[model samples]
Target: MSSNLAGNQATERKRRIEKYFQPTPKDSLKQIAVALLAGGGIAVLLGLILLSSQSFLAVLLFIGGGYALVQGAIRKARYKAEYEKAEPKPSDREMDRTLALDLQQIEDRAMHRLGITADHLETGAASWDPVAALLADKMVERPKKRPLVLYGPKLSDFGIGEDGVWRFKLYEVLVICPTVHHLAIYHCSLDFLSGGLSMEDTEEYQYNHVVAVSTRTTPAPADLSLERLNTRDPEDDEVRFAKVLRRRLEVSVSNGQSIGVTVGITDEQDSSKQAVLQSSGIDEVIGSVRRVLRDHSRP
Candidate 1:
């Protein structure tokens, strides 16, 4: 009577648990059978060893274990096959469409898909000397070793909005050995910069690129020099400096947002130094800033 009552309670408890955590019939059966067979075999082996089991008993135990193993294998194979069958395959048309687009177009489409706004994009260029690439690879390979500093008042001037919120980063470009026909590129971002930006479901980080080019150039002056210019807003010393450079060299600023530069060796001695900025897409990104920079720079 006590055993019967205990069994009834266990059954009731199992039913209640199953109501909240329902599993498929096949899976539940397989799990229960595997657990029971495994536990029972282990218990029987221990018991038989203690009892000094007859040869016939040992043979029966071995046969049962083999059967259990085969059963488990069959169930696992079926489960894997069912899972693969359930997954959807992409259509050929979809794959073809993706393969058809050029890199720039692909970038644009990805941006559109992610719902990134024009305001969300930030553009900047870094010189890509082979020496620099090697140095950069060192940094990239061991990011934690070289902790980036987020310090300094310079970052503060990046701006705070009228609503008392700060604008974060949305996009970034690292141009390596930029030239008229080709460039080497590295794209990156920090979470702080991208946190507020809206992006597409499938899109994660802003697109980054590395490119190489073979032709054309933008001229840079013989001496790399810096000069400060006064501005209405002291906070924009960096922007003002950029503006001064644009005025002197004819680089452009776009949408009050982007900076478009045309950089190269000024003369014959600087051939290997090469052009560092001459990207059409860079102009597209900077918008009318291109005209401002180009017009000013034109001889």
Candidate 2:
């Protein structure tokens, strides 16, 4: 009696779960009608051929139907096996612990690279408000109703540049949302313009338009230190440095409609700055964003 009661409870639970995913009445009716029409047509055709004294044709029809049914059953079994293999077997607590550890490691690495403490680091979900405001101020399209999560380090300390005319602060933000993920935004603010251009003159320049996106690639490590390479022989240096200078990521969207800017974190025009950016965990961040994009883009 106890065993029967347990089985009944298990069956009831399954039914409740399946109820949410069950097809609508309209869809079920349409599928049934199609199946009936196809099966009935095949049966009628085979029956008519059998009645016409075509014993050989009837045999062929039976053979064909049997082959088709066997193939269908095989395919169904294969699909079920594959699905079972892919399903996670771990307990919920185990999965949660693994995920938590991974996130903690990522956060720690990011904080170390950005020179920020734990207090300065905000959870991805909490950081979206500032990003939304920035988008609104720039008249950019706001993200959809879907959840937006962003992991951002606090702004860097203000410092005056060598030119003495400009003081700036720099920081990086990581955005993860339903449609967009692992998006890294490098931000900079200059206290004043150095080239006779007033602060007002640069105000018209849209910084948001500078956003860009790229897919990351892992290249074999090579030493490209200029000091170690022969500076006198330009050709030799170029040949040796070529492999090291290869881009770690390829641009996907430049001035894209979704992000409203080219997402390039480093300026290609400045080779020195580009090299520095590459070494400073920019590739890792971009790689994360690319992964998220790929996962979400799938049907």
Candidate 3:
């Protein structure tokens, strides 16, 4: 009984969300506009014919008809612009596939660099943390020794509102493996938006050198820099009213530099897309980083 109630409540919430984006019915608006235009045309013609004798009535007709015509034209124009979406293109599906392939390549590269065998990895013996379980579920190779990873979208910002509320994401994967003396972090970026893989970057941070780890959402900078990172998360009106929003997660490291992962909920995205954009995955990855710092960072 409780489960059923929860399901219904969820359904209602989604319905409300979808409703917020919807405008007046396109067909209804178009029909009313056409009617007004036709009526206004007839009224103007009658007024012109009666101007010689019925001047007062003709003047009234002219005023009313002109008002109706203007109103109708305005409404009609709005409908045309708001309803006429451009034809769907192959680029959407192609982009999705391209991103997937790029991410897969980076994951493979990380596994190879970390010395995880290609034969297979058993999740049964992997870390029980949610992030580890998720990595294990990939059936991909991950170092069994204090393995951790921080991965998310890189900065993606486009000038066009055609992306709607959500901009596309280019992913960066950071695979961290701890050694007796230091932590070897293997990282790479996959940018399918334009094309091709970014060069792999591997750096070793001594236990004591490693300092802070965090995840935060901030306004995407025009230049994608680390400066001026202070900003509040978008709320009800802020999200709903904005035409486009480019968001990224800033991950701070011991080094002066920080990395960004693209992830967030945007106004125009539906519930399913919103779920996919949830920051939970990013948070879990951060959680893994913290665990590593707690257990292995220079004491």
Model 2: per-residue lDDT, tens digit, 1-299?
A: 99898678656543432222122233344445455445545854785679569877777766665555555555555545544432323322332233233333433444444344433322332222333333232222223232222222112222211222111122222323222323332222221111111111101112233234453423324443322332112233222223322333332333443321112222233344322210123343444444545554566
Please rank every candidate by lDDT, starting with the best. 3, 2, 1
- Residue 177, model 1: Cα distance from true site in angstroms: 53
The TM-score of predicted model 1 comes to 0.19
Q: Give the Cα lDDT of each candidate.
A: 0.30, 0.33, 0.50
| True-vs-predicted CA distance for residue 203, candidate 1, Å | 42
Lowest lDDT 10-mer window, candidate 2? Answer: 195-204
After TM-score superposition, the amount by which residue 242's alpha carbon in candidate 3 deviates from its true location, in angstroms, is 5.6
Models sorted by TM-score, best on top: 3, 2, 1
Tell me the spans in candidate 1 whose CA falls farther than 4 Å from its real position: 1-26, 29-33, 36-52, 87-299
Q: Candidate 1: minimum summed lDDT over ten consecutive residues — where? A: 145-154
Q: Cα deviation in Å at residue 43, candidate 3?
A: 24
